[model samples]
Target chain A: MRLERRASVPPILYVAAPLAAVMVALAISGALIALAGASVPEAYRRMAIGAFGSRLAITETLTRATPLILTGLAAAVAFRARLWNIGAEGQFYIAALATAALGGAASAGGLLPGPLLIPFLMICGAAVGAMLLLAPLALRLRFGVDEVVVTLLLNFVVLLFVSMMIDGPLRDRMAFGWPQSVRVSPEAALPKLWQGTRLHVGLLVAVAMSVVVWIIQSRTAFGLEAKAAGFNPRAAAFAGVPIPKVLVGVACLSGGLAGLAGAIEVMGVKGYVTTDLSPGFGYAGIVVAMLAALNPIGVVAASLFVAATFVGVDGMSRALKVPSFIADVTVALSLLCVLVALTLVTYRIRR
Target chain B: MSETLDILASASLWAAVLRIATPLLFGVLGALLCERSGVLNLGIEGIMTFGAMIAWLTVFKTGDLWFGLAAALACGALFGLLHGGLTVVLGLSQHVAGLGVTLLGSSLSYYLYRLAIPVSGSPPTITPFQPLKIPLLSDIPLLGEALFSQTAPTYLAILLTLAVAYALAKTPLGLAIRLVGENPHAAEAQGLDPIRLRIGVVAFGSALMALGGAFLTTAAFNSFFPTMVQGRGWVCIALVVFASWMPLRALGGALLFAFFDAFQLRLQHVTGKAAPYQLFLMIPYLMSIAALVVFARRAKVPQALMQPYRRGER
Candidate 1:
């Protein structure tokens, strides 16, 4: 058998591919549900209901999707340029900590007025995240190092650094020796979109950012240059696209998006930083981006799918005694399946 | 200063270095073998995690440590097959596919563990491998106790290093693999199947990686826990660059890294409250980045590394 590239791909394949991938992933994970001695159909029914059943359930899923949307965009932006920023997890942690630190100090010292504090913390948080990624990117540019390994290794380093800060300088005194940072001031908390629900304005910000990113990617000159560099760096360089500057710009935007996820996550939900602040939100972002085929607008939909899977799986597991890790397995399977589906969209097998 | 010097003089410290180096020894060699054949297995982290879990589970169930190790190797080969099929046969993105494999392996391991074993205060344990003493070597001075008295897997890891180094340098098969990595067209012209060679090598290399994970549970620790593999798999990837894709140098790199790890652990104990323990934990990761900076420029990378091979395409 041989594979032949298609001259033109139908627009419908873009929509059909992810949907088909998710169906296949669910069918495969159904076996795991059966293995856990739960009825597969029943378990799936529970998952769907748990995700969308009540006002509370829908709000919780959206709240979960808020950080995922930002992180998904982070991965989408970086992966588009082929930057492979695996350190999003680390960037999330560091940015969250930075936001918390700024929020606490600003409130305690009366340093900034209430209305301005949130935006200030958000900007500072993103800057810190941007700088974190630039270190690895600089290494790649100067030394010709593969950014994949360097970015991955930095995740562990950043996590440890966060651990040290929460346990030492950032530790909350009144929390009875628990290793967590002091709470962000009320002034720094993001306003809730609906009263009596956990859903905050972060969801609105995430949805708006998705639209903004889509416009930047599809309608801007810089996006065209970035895509050109990604397609063929040698050709782009020969065309005077300035590959280094483009990569640096992509790195900042990608890192800033991830950092903003951390900042918003703290302000909107937890109100404090801990080692377990993110349940692999950074890693999940990669899967979300891939499932969306690295499209900025598609990332919002993909994040919602992932967040629902996770939130729904939690409720399903509680009801059926199935392991919650099935959510991770499902997400991972969809990523691999989507990769294959995307390949099929571009190429056909001939025997 | 004297307290720091005293750590270097202790026999136990040297022994700890070897113990810590054992898993890394397997991991670096596994990664090196795969990369030398033009396939980058970024799935090492998840592969190792699965290996650690499956081996411990096997031992816990059957009460046979060797069987547990065998189970881990078998499961690892299966994961490798999945990874190899994706990258080699399907011609997918190596980066994304490997990450998918990692996610699948780790989460599946956790799911299986939770399914098989009920949640409790602490995870179950098994009788791990005890250190074996080489008769006369164990009687010698500091070097004897540190080097000669180690678990069976530690010795196997060292011997495997020599075997890999020799096979790569002297064997025709190794030459074919290297040729495939450098220029598959040349290998194809010479009547070798680059596709099969890459798939086979990735599978075998991944088995070694699983054994490295097995070592963590069966020797380094007696119990299995989530995330225990930590970032050791990633550190091994860096060591591959540090070694410049040579087996003997890979061995040296693993030892050097483990020495830093062992020393920092000791330093943590010596300093007590003077510094935070997390800072010491950060040393190995920071050191890997520093090593990459130092050697990445000078290293000769495999020409076809990370490039997917199509039967007829250049």
Candidate 2:
């Protein structure tokens, strides 16, 4: 029997809770800054002013936030279906590799202009990612395999494969002994959104994907089916929901979006692929998705906050003598705190 | 023909393989015991790493390797306690909370390194554990030399594996641990606290994990690097799954993986083989995923795996 619990909290309060939790996280972080021997007030001001101080920083934050948004969406979608696609990091690499091939081939042929080639390459990239994801997804659906372990392990496989490519076949001949791919042709490069900034069409694509995802997640029949599957498989089965089918369906879509993020970064930000292109963006997406409580709208806001934490840390590093890893430590600590806090929103702490 | 003889005749390579396999064996066995108790300890890699880091750090400060080993064991046991507390007591999501512990341990270890090294603390090249010679067996040509000639921790790992296997299969408490894993509710109904059983198994597993890491810091790498693990934890996870939750099978799987790893290292120095190292490294990961896909259909996790049981629940 269900316990006599308090009534469910309002949606608005749930929406605002993450932000409120983030503020508390910041207060703790401020103390950390103080411990780092920096003035807390000045550090906070610098963090805010640094992220929005100029077009470049703002653009950088947006550009950084782009992948976070896609990865967040990817995570949100998969988790919504109760399929933990833990290998998004590897999927990101595979997808980026797919786009890199297109960027190289199309640019080499001089067949299409940069604007036209970019979208096609991005689509190709997404397709590669979806293809890789289908393996584990199919296994989970058809064979009842544990998606979590399969997906997580595949991440390393994909990562190593990508590293192999960069180190071997993709290694630039003219680069004088560096592990990097050939540069994408100017024709494949994304159009810059602002002058003197690395921001490009990738950020715009990320925003568009988020909006479409919101509509799909909240307004579509497929979305409802997915949620039903996650909340209670037995109930969904009783209701005749194709649980496995829906799980695979959502996994493919999630992997595709994650792949698109990888593709965009290749075509937009770093013209040539490097080993460090998407640094833990796959894993960070989990953090972002969880931080937002998997709300598409919340994802948008949460990623920016997460991004700001890093931008602020970089700012602090430059302004003060503290290392930037301090920012990473603080962010990780904040995430742990936020997770504990978020769980409380759903389940009351009895003890 | 002579090449095969050279490869086989060199006792050093076999010794190296066994040496490298020691840590992996420890990790896999540690994980094996925990899973037997129905607790999949995903934090083995991090716990192991932290144990190594702490062991090395302590050894360096105290100048006593045994004390350092004790500290490492303590560090590992604490993490196991945390995992047990969250999964068994508090009933938090095991997978996520275990992952959180990994992140926490990994991050803390790196931070401690940063605090200690200050960009200049001799990039983690500790004076690793020295080889311990088993008095009479050290005289054997190849087999005995390969197996017996190693660090104290390596010998300890082998003993622990044999002991753990026996305890889990033969002991009364082991039956209780198995009962908790297979059916925690039933075990509780039978008057055994599933939570305590889980905690015990996990703590025992974690202590072994710390020993694995200590082998690395004190004996393998001699110091901790930020990325020293480089996804070894994930490897451990794959090793367990590939073995289908069987301790004996896990031992085999882990040995195979260690063999692949050692083989890859050997090939790295051979002419025109550097590129293959990347591909070779993928073998274990690929095998694990494939095993998960291929065998997951038949394998069954403990009834209560990843599910937190509330006391006196409906």
Candidate 3:
């Protein structure tokens, strides 16, 4: 009998592979922890406790997860359409700036009520975010420019622009010369979900958005066209689907979601923009999107899991004195492992 | 207006341009080899970090600069091997594999550095490479000071660019590599192993990238820090496009970016609180985007770039 590669493997393998990949990633992280002179089991226990051991811990996890959910969705939506829009980080920065500028000005002016102000700022944030990708999108469609590098380079430009704003125009004179934007008006702030906890309505909004995305992706004709464009662009173009329009639309939606995250972050959490506000949330979003296999509902689960790692690892570092970067290593390893695992699930050995 | 003129007339400003361009030159050349071999090594950012850390750590330990450089080169080759295995052997997606390699390199370097070096107090320092004045050439006026008096790596970068330009145009090995990149099936039909050639080129290119990283620490700053590479690797990716995959053109692109970078740093001192220096910092990045928009239509990218080669597959 000759061995051959089968076209498809059992469906069970798809589910099992990611789970195995997670286990392998955790195991590798355990070794890293040991190298850092921490007891793996003790550190892990601390992490779990930090992530979900108490109501306060759970709230903190959700709080940390709010932006992640949005960014993850951003990557998923764009990547699903093969748009390669890696500038979510820059879009998030742009949105944060827009939110801070508009929210602070409107609130200080008492131009809108609290309920109205928050929604208005968020909408502006999303709009600005979408606008950020217009150049990259145009270049990609018109000139066949590689969106990946263009998007990546744009991240730096937007970040520097924000830094300039914070240092110059947006500086709060009342705050004694800090490199930060003016405080947003209390009216523009996102209301807390729980009065006693840091949890805010932003979490609810993120989850709601995920459901909306899931419906759009699974139930809409546009979603079908997006899937077709991504999997086989030539075929989609031959079939008369507006490939360019679909890509541009998906990029806008992705950028909008990411911008919403930045707005929520500023309005709900930071209340101002700082240079170090995001700890690579945009980059981590790629991992989250890939781990979820670009499924909107699965993005929710992936976001929460990644959020827990961030929260848990902070505690692990404090208790075990290990460097928190081990968490990043784990996430990266999981990405590589999942890719391999998924590839395995795509093929079977036939005799 | 007079201050601007003075800044332009200063010898140091031009020297700074040459200095700033040195590491970027190494990176652009490194990326050139990989892209020319039909691989997009987005891992350049992370691999550079590995080189920087290894070079700093090795030099800090042994007090030997060459040893540090060697260690960095080895680490870069190792990461390139990892990228090659994932993309060439396993037939994984180039974009994902490249990003994965980047994440792995960056995080691993950070973790290892934290473990090896203590966090408290000042970081260990080394006597960084000092500029060597060329005997007769240093006597020349403006150009000599900017070009002749330089660190070893700066000179090496120039030599390497010329050597690479020559190799790509003149050598049979270069032709074989180009053949594999352009049309692997055709290369295979000529009895050349496409996968092996791709892997070899990737490894060689990555080794050059690692050297560039080492130059950042050992020659430029004498100390390594996380994020010091600071998107230069990504800039090199853009430079590849800007140069249209030509080594000589990449040299010009690298210098153009370096000039803006050095000028930005100088402009910051004169224009303090008047203009946002951040805008000046954005010049190189913005120029790159502008360059892409202008030249992307004309740039002849390698035919098989970003595609995985598999035997007997259509």
Candidate 4:
């Protein structure tokens, strides 16, 4: 009833709201599990141990988290400039294709050593990815088009485009009509950082990019323009800031990072691109960015949280015989629950 | 010239057009109603799934196709009511609330469907409804055969387009929905409840959409599939924006999309030409992107399509 009690507040309430929402979501999910004739504690235990307990599991989780870290950053970057880039999955696939094509060429060139070749591949991947994203971003800013709808719709277009490539041009000659491209040479591969695991240099790149994003957003002038433009375009325009340029530039960075994610997955791990190289990483980026509340550092933490849920789904599915798809349901539920809870950051949550 | 004449000879191409347009027609007409009421029914995909599930379940249990179709629409109406209740009454954010409804319906449908037939070699499939051939027109040449020879809902979809076109342009109730969409406060001054109007419009729209889902399972495929709509609801959403909130225009957009899909399915059979298949597949999405690119800022969206409507206080 006391809606006017804004005079009394605590800073920690912002922190508490997210925590409370998670607890509430878990409780609701527990009720759902009960409806499904399952035990909540048993389910949680299965999910947690599956995600974080085993070394192999952690490695697998890292592999999953690698792309997320990049795509989340991709989302975070465009969102920083207020460009809604929702086609990262498409960007990722195309980037993967570019990276794979480069990898195929690089392996053929035995002249370049390991030190020079790896960076060369990554740069090519990033550049190709950036170029693809540039067109949409250009039209969006220059024409005053809403990037959200265009980028979202572009996702399907890119997927179909990739499908065409794999089906027609990229299909391996030796693989008996398979949809995957040729595997890259071992020399062109991203070296495994862990001896007995699939985890590699991509995870490090993700971590480094997080730091770079943090610096860019908090310290750089471009970042300041992004914040100004995002918070209020009219106000920023009144202050003589170039809103369109900032939006386009930010969208490129977003597309570039998404492209980079695709490249890394190809170069560091898969060594080749397939039709299903990306499994909705862009959509997951939406959830990650929203969970972070547009904070880059928050994105790092949010990506890990999402990674854990995906990992846990695998574990619970095996032990409890619950379908792995429940992971998606859980993530969706958590996102809504968390957003609703975040309302307390702005308004009072009266009993 | 003789080669060109040979290229033009095909009835299946027209058949493919009707087959593809059926669902888009059902979903887009439903979208037209909701947009007119200023409630952007973003959960059309999820509602379609719910409708398909219930309709299939009814058919599976009862074996009566008509009642099954009725049940599908009823499920859609029920969901539309819920969407109306949450956004129109509780004043929740429609995007998130609608998405929640979608996730809830889809997840629940998936889980329930799995429970009914668990761990099978293949997901259990249903026999699709029979096509209702027109009395005289089924035998007619290219135009008559393509337009009239389809499942009951295919004809129903065309009938729906006419009904929506007429209702939206000629009815007083349609004006009320429009008034609610454009300026709810002004509508209230005219002695109408914006909230009640929204509820009715959304429910009606949902029923119309649910029929689209039923059409998919019964008339098109003859069985249920998970995530079968595959973002078609969102396509319907794009159609609404692309059409700038007009019924006949929505039909045009729907048919264009259906033609793209049908054209793609046909492209795979050209004796060896493969590249165009990808281009064909990309058409609907490309059109959506092109539409938003060209008209997003200029398009006249319903004034309160996504804004939550609070009952009182300035």
Instruction: Go through the candidates in order and give each one's DockQ.
Output: 0.87, 0.46, 0.63, 0.40
Regarding lDDT, does 1 or 4 come out ahead? 1
Candidate 3 per-residue C-alpha lDDT over A1-351 given as tens digits, one digit per residue, 9 for 90 to 100: 112355667888877888899889999989989998889999999999999999989999999888999999999999888888788899999999989988889877889988888889999988888888877998888998899889899999999999999888898767765589988998887889988988999999999999999989889999889989999999999999999899888988999998998899999998999888888888888888988888888888888888899898988798788988888898999888888777667644343
Off by over 4 Å in 3: A1-5, A348-351, B1-5
TM-score per candidate, chains pooled: 0.99, 0.92, 0.97, 0.89
Ranked by DockQ, the better of candidates 1 and 2 is: 1
How high is the TM-score of chain A in model 4? 0.93
Which candidate comes out best when scored by TM-score?
A: 1
Ranking by DockQ, best first?
1, 3, 2, 4
**i-RMS, each model, one decimal:** 0.8, 3.1, 2.3, 3.4
TM-score of 4: 0.89
For model 2 the local lDDT of residue A165 reads: 86
Model 2 score (lDDT): 0.76
**lDDT score for residue B291 of model 2:** 65
Global CA lDDT of candidate 3, please?
Answer: 0.87
> What digit string (tens of lDDT, one per residue) describes model 1 on residues B114-209?
999989998888999999999999989999999999999999999999999999889999999899899988999999998899999999999999
Q: Candidate 3, what DockQ?
A: 0.63
lDDT of 3 at B8: 80
Candidates, ranked, TM-score:
1, 3, 2, 4
Which candidate number would show the highest lDDT if scored against the true structure?
Answer: 1
**Cα-based lDDT for every prediction:** 0.92, 0.76, 0.87, 0.76
Question: What is candidate 3's lDDT per residue for B118-190, written digit by digit as tens?
Answer: 6957777898888989999987998788888898889989999999999998999889888888899999999
Off by over 4 Å in 2: A1-7, A10-13, A20-46, A142-144, B1-9, B121-124
